[model samples]
Target: MSRDTGTDTAGMTFLESTPKKMLNAYLPLGAFLFVLLFPFYWMAITAFKPDNELLSRDGNPFWINSPTLAHVKKLLFDTAYPEWMWNTVVVSVTATFFSLAASVLAAYAIERLRFSGAKQVGLAIFLAYLVPPSILFIPLASVVFQLGLFDTRLALILTYPTFLIPFCTWLLMGYFRSIPFELEECALIDGATRWQILTKIVLPLAVPGLISAGIFAFTLSWNEFIYALTFVSSSEIKTLPVGVVTELVEGDVYHWGSLMAGALFGSLPVAFIYSFFVEYYVSGMTGSVKE
Candidate 1:
């Protein structure tokens, strides 16, 4: 009877009781956040923990009572971590630049040039990205040896493009497709060359896609272990991912604190980069999907 007097407000209520909101959304999200962040929490605690506390079976293991800088000192001073960090930065940056350059040209050709079998070519290029690095590493190693690039950062810088190019090309093509062909047609009528159109108009508009592709390529290069391990032998030329794993552990012995410190430091740059460019990344993805 009361319900007849007042129409149902079910759709009007954005949220119900506090307990319902907590149960329906907050609890699940909180649990996911806890699971996701627990590793970093443990890593931070372990990195600052003294050897005694880390090894001891007593006291609270989750929290560090007395934090020390011993692990940080060891990671910075005793290890080739600094060199590894530098190598990672140089290789990742160079590879990303090269990949983006090649991908832009390739994507433009595939999307705007209207070449024969362009769609098929794009599909093939994307399929190349599906090829596992594990399978590719063997032949790539032979090529690296034959080219006399073994045990050098150049091998990684060059070979990373092989994989990076395909993915970046596919991503950029999607973005380029989202753009109006009318612009290019108008430019053609106005006597603008393809190079001028791309450099002056297309590239400027595709900045978000470029950033997304660059960030992806850089992150992949940073975290790549199989290729880094296969191509580079010197500890000084190793990437952060390879160096931390190979250099930190001895037979039946693990330098837990120093290892965790390396991991924490290694992850910080990527986290910072993603946090800064999240908006552009989202826009790029949305634009690509709209095509």
Candidate 2:
């Protein structure tokens, strides 16, 4: 009886013990959550903190002593932040729309059309995505200048697709491949045209993939800095990322409160989008289809 009891205890000890579970699961999860969330927490607190507390080294930096809305008010009323936000939304939406439209056709063609050199073409598209924006931006800047689109929202709307299209195409190609080809064949046998087949059968099933691509494209366009900064010079045409950085700081003087406020507000929309469509995003990324 003693020997049996010892064996049972040893077998159960490491994997099922409370302390071991805490160490292996809870502790690691807690650490990850802290690391992931600490920056946003800091940004939120800093946005609301008064200048005195923000600048002073005396009090607990983690906690807000006196939260105020002055920074937010200034950001909204005293600056071109509203215009910046509007510009960002407009440019991002337009670019994502066009990118998705083009990518859908490209991905569907490459994946379903059985065209010659399709794989090579798809490879070329993915390779385009690997090109760093920093290098590409220079020539793009000259083109924008030549076209006299400098300091205009149109420049960014057009230029963003240069990067957005390749990535979205690559993503959607993988998704389109996961879909069963027999669906298209069945539609074809029933005398459906290619366009009808694509519109009716393929698109309905690819909603998650479309949303996922849109999310990625929109986020990239929204947060893009180099093209926005290079192509747009006017405050009214600037996107949130560039506007906040340029307008909030003055030669070694950082407006920490207003800067944090801008960042926090700008980030909220993307976070909300991700949380809302996370299910579809995951499904799309996995590229799995039910037959």
Q: Which candidate is the best by TM-score?
A: 1
TM-score of 1: 0.91
Candidate 2 residue-wise lDDT, 1-291, digit = tens:
013333455444465779888987789999999999999998999999999999999968889977999999999999999999999999999999999999999999999996999989988987898799999889999999999999998999899999989888888887788789899999999999999998999999888789888887888888899999888888888999999988888688789999999999999988888898876555544532221
Encode model 1's per-residue lDDT on 121-194: one tens digit a residue.
98898788778899999999999999999999999999999888987898898778878989988999999999
Over 4 Å off, model 1: 1-15, 282-291
Model 2 TM-score on a 0 to 1 scale: 0.90
By lDDT, the best candidate is 1
Candidate 1: residue 83 lDDT (0-100): 92
| Candidate 1 local distance difference test against the native | 0.88
Candidate 2: regions farther than 4 A off:
1-14, 283-291
* RMSD of each predicted structure: 6.3, 7.2
